[model samples]
Target: MAQDRAQKNRPHYALASVDHALRLAVMLQVEGPLSVSDAAERLGVARSTAHRLLSMLVYRDFARQGEDRRYHAGPVISLTADSQSRTALLRTVALPHLHALVGRLGESANLLVLAGDYARFIGSVESSQALRVGNREGMVFPAHLTSGGKLILADLTPAEREELYAAQRWDGREGERPDPAALEQELAVVRDRGFAINKDRTETGVTAVGRGVRVGDRVGAAVTVSMPTVRFDESRLVDIVSALALASRDIEHDLQAALRVEA
Candidate 1:
């Protein structure tokens, strides 16, 4: 019984040690270089054990031990990230649908992700028009004033919306950020309407309509079709809204499939 108890405890202790080593590596990645003693202190392990873990990590190129004896994340981990980003499975899956919409409508289409208090434009298909009104890729804009932002905001719970707005300092930033009561009213209408519209809110002559692009239970992102107000009159608005809704559904389906495979 004593020997069996020792055997069981040995594997548990080994796993704990491995866990500590992984924690040390992750800490180095997040907090930059750390001496062995510092890593040991943060992990509540002895210097010798930390040294052994660092050696193993260095051998695998997960970390590099510098002349200063401080450890930092190394090329192997960075290469893995580069590889994953290059794949960009979301963009790959959505491209066909986005191109179809752009080709059919002759208006710009974009994919946006909510980052901090803003919507970041990740990808876009430019309108074929001689004059353009849509945002360029990699542009970041206030979420409270754009159709993509409104689409994302409309899907959030009231509590979640309050938390986001509080962090963003919306009151001071936007001249037209609706008061909480008014925002709540607008959000209710957005939810019922199944899409959101921006009427020259972000830029003077541009108008856009957007719909939520969801992945599973999470509102992963949004899609928008944008044009100048003169080009997108009331009749054209209906066509654009309908096209965006279809494109959103297609993107959501692909996003869900990609996520399932990733899982």
Candidate 2:
């Protein structure tokens, strides 16, 4: 009897239904209100399957059906989108700088800021190289493991900095992650250096350099250039530093200008 019950429970783990429901929600999220046929076409599923998935989404507040019978992501998703919009505005202002840096350096340039306890990529520009390190916008990486993350985090107050690491995961390799006291010491060095360097901290072959974007006393964001370690040797350190500092100043000026326009 126990074996039979286990067999019955195994079917619940299939999750095909869950995948369809999530796809329906994402379709509604990106494409706005979608008819059953429209969603089915996007997901390459049968119309009946799409309708069933959307019904489940409605039950979970992930989507809603209007009087026109089109499904839209519900209020819960709208609130999240509103928050993302604020970040999107910052990314828009920083994109030109990021692109210019990538064009000049011939590497991947990323714009990042603190998001909760992690560093979130808000924008990125890549060189024309066939092989490159690319970043997905809005992807979050651990704060202690990236140059841009360290540059931004170093600007936070000591108390705020402690709060940031309280829940952080120290999954970095040996010697890369240290206790609270050690992190404080490292941050001090980063502050003095005016630029942060990550030597294979995030990935084995990736090296990155970053400078903070300061708006008056506060750091609004950071800009980073990521390249393969072989390409980022000490010979290029001076040039990288000069390029990043120039980019940082440009970003700060842009931020201040946007603030004036807003005011």
Candidate 3:
């Protein structure tokens, strides 16, 4: 029994629950990522207990809930410095495509990556049209309120989504969050369609459509086109979606090639 304990020397006064939580944290930091069920199985605990433990970990920023619905080492974890090389490579491969998208649709295009609970615009190309939306590069927006943000958030599992939008987090800032039911309905639609559309949701008189840039089964980023609301005709939606999809594919292809070369 002592040998099976998390530590070689099990303390007489060690609280089992605390030990379990610590062990889970270690597993997250060392094992990369794991689901609640996986943690429970490994820790020999009940599912509810595992969930409570993981929630506490998230609350303390000891672990983070990933888009894949697994827990990864949070910022507080003492891992090696995160390399910005991936983001740099992604931006390098995606800039040309953003410009091409602007040339094709005559609308501003942006490339964004998930940053914590926000979407960070890393690449942007403004349209030449007099009435077009301007460059939004280096801007960060609430993940739930942006076109690309919603598309990426919709890709997370239900448990991961719950952690991100936990009721307690919105206590004083209720207005900033969307109605749970309405947001769920919209996310379901975005998931089914593999894209998202925004119309005056984040900014007034601006409309946008976004598609995820995928590398194999994982989405690496979101590519979107934003235009003036007056020019956002419902008839043009199909064309906008098609253009956005092509841009996404182009970015993903180049990103894959770049990463392959690096590997």
Candidate with the greatest TM-score versus the true structure: 2
Per-model TM-score versus the true fold = 0.64, 0.68, 0.67
Candidate 3 residue lDDT tens string, 53-172: 999999999999989999887878645433345665787799899999989889999998887667878777889988888666656677777789888888878787787888887787
| C-alpha lDDT (0 to 100) for residue 72 of candidate 3 | 81
Clashing pairs in 3: none
Task: Residues 27-133, candidate 1: write the lDDT tens digits.
Answer: 55434677989878766789998899998999998899888879877776543443334224555677687788888788888877776667866667778888875
Judged by whole-model lDDT over C-alpha atoms, candidate 2 comes out at 0.73
Model 2 TM-score (2 dp) = 0.68
Candidate 2 ranges with C-alpha deviation above 4 Å: 1-85, 167-178
**Which is better, 1 or 3, measured by lDDT?**
3
Ranking by TM-score: 2, 3, 1
lDDT (Cα, tens digit) per residue for candidate 2, span 1-263: 32122111123365867656765564455336789998787567899988888888888898999999888788766436654444555666788988888888899998887766567676777777776775534456667666888887788899987765653443443233336787788888999999899877656567888999885578767889988777778888888889899998887887778867867
Task: Tell me the number of clashing residue pairs for each predicted model.
Answer: 0, 0, 0
Off by over 4 Å in 3: 1-83
Better of 2 and 3 by lDDT: 3
- By TM-score, the better pick of 1 and 2 is 2
Q: Ranking under lDDT, best-scoring first?
A: 3, 2, 1
Tell me the spans in candidate 1 whose CA falls farther than 4 Å from its real position.
Answer: 1-87, 167-178
